[model samples]
Target: MKPLKEVAMSYMALSEAQKKLEEGAFGEAAGESSKAMEFSKTMPPGETFDHDGFDALCYAVLASARAGLGEYDACLEASGRALHYFNRRGELQQDEGKQWIAVVFSRGVAFHETGVYDEALKNLNMAGEMITERKGELPGKEAMLKEIERRKSMLLEEEKSQRKPGYKAWWEFWS
Candidate 1:
């Protein structure tokens, strides 16, 4: 069995990676997240230890780093893996709402970058809803809400711009 200190160190590494991601050090964040993931592999998996949440957090940080590096597809893939881990632990919604929000927001940003505006809006809206539902209780709620609103507005503008002006549906074209 791995030492408890090792697992704690892995968590600390993940936190550092998250900080690097927020600081816009994409390459460094990715490297730190990878190191944490390697350490996670050494720990025994169990719900009691929150191994799933740890894995999810690592993937979420990795996704954010990938997005910052403009690797949209890889960002989406990593965010999906993070959500997969989060979903596997159904109880995580109450305890790890913030992590869930991060993963979803990462996916939304990736989708937006990839030109999937609808999916981006859906994910951003979901993240917004999660924040709103947990408002005042969650840390960084205001910042998360602001980011979501900004992304939503951007997506709406892009979607509107993508539409052809004065274009009509087939049925309307006949009229």
Candidate 2:
């Protein structure tokens, strides 16, 4: 088992990272989240308490921070890691609604930043549904849901504009 000091430090780093993220300090948030992830990694595999959710949360923060810093590829990568951890946690038991929502929301943002409109909208929709179902558990639920809807609407418009009518063949003009 990891030392109590390491566990406390990990949580402290995570909280600091979250605060930095909320304050729009992307670089600092990323650093702190990385620290949290590093500490979490030191915990042995198959420990008494599964720390997958904690790892997922750290990755979610990192993803959002990367997105804020315009590191789309890194953001997507971190979001993928977050999703993997979240899935692992889910397989063991039901994940906390807040952690699940955070992971989904970060993934949606990452996808949106990477110009994957379809995936972004899908994730955002999932987050919105989760928020609705877990309304009592999520703080600022209305704002978060509104933001998801806004992103979905924006993606829809962008995707529509990017589409063009296609012809089967250049030679088959008019029959």
Candidate 3:
């Protein structure tokens, strides 16, 4: 196992990344999250803690940061990795469940920005369900729910506007 000091430092960096993200300093948040990920990589094999969940948290932070910077493709890629790690954990602990919400939300936004409306809406719906299910565990639950709804509405509006006003079916020919 890696030294306890190193593990502590990694968590500290992750904490800082979270703070920077909350402050809207996307670049700094990404840097800190990357640092945390690198530090965690140095950890010796067979550590007792949930390394996958930790890695997922780092990727989720990076995804959110990238999304804030308008780098949707990178955001989606990172979020996908985060989701992979999250799924690998199987049944989630309370903390991991909280992180999962953020991962899903960021992924949804990335998909929406990339014009993948179906996937975007699917993820947003998932996030909303997750938040609702974990309402007691999450702080600012009401605000998060509102934000999810707002994003869902935004996605729907965009999808509607982007659709071509053509026939609904192969048999339909009316204008």
Candidate 3 lDDT over 58-97, as tens digits, reads 9989998999999999999999999997776734347767
lDDT of 1 at 112: 86
> Which tens-of-lDDT digit does each residue in 1-175 have in candidate 1?
5558678778889989978987889999999998998887776665256666788888888988998899999999999989898767634347566677777888998898888988999999987877777644665677778888898998888777877999777999998
- Please give the distance, in angstroms, between residue 11's alpha carbon in candidate 1 and its true position after superposition: 1.7
- lDDT of the candidates, in the order given: 0.82, 0.79, 0.84
Q: Give per-residue CA lDDT, model 2, range 102-174, as digits (tens).
A: 7688778778877888889999998887776763546557778888888998999897777676634456766
Ranking of candidates on lDDT, top first:
3, 1, 2
Best by TM-score: 3
- The residue pairs found clashing in candidate 3 are none
Task: Write down the TM-score of every candidate.
Answer: 0.79, 0.78, 0.83
Tell me model 3's lDDT, rounded to 2 decimals: 0.84
Clashing pairs in 1: none
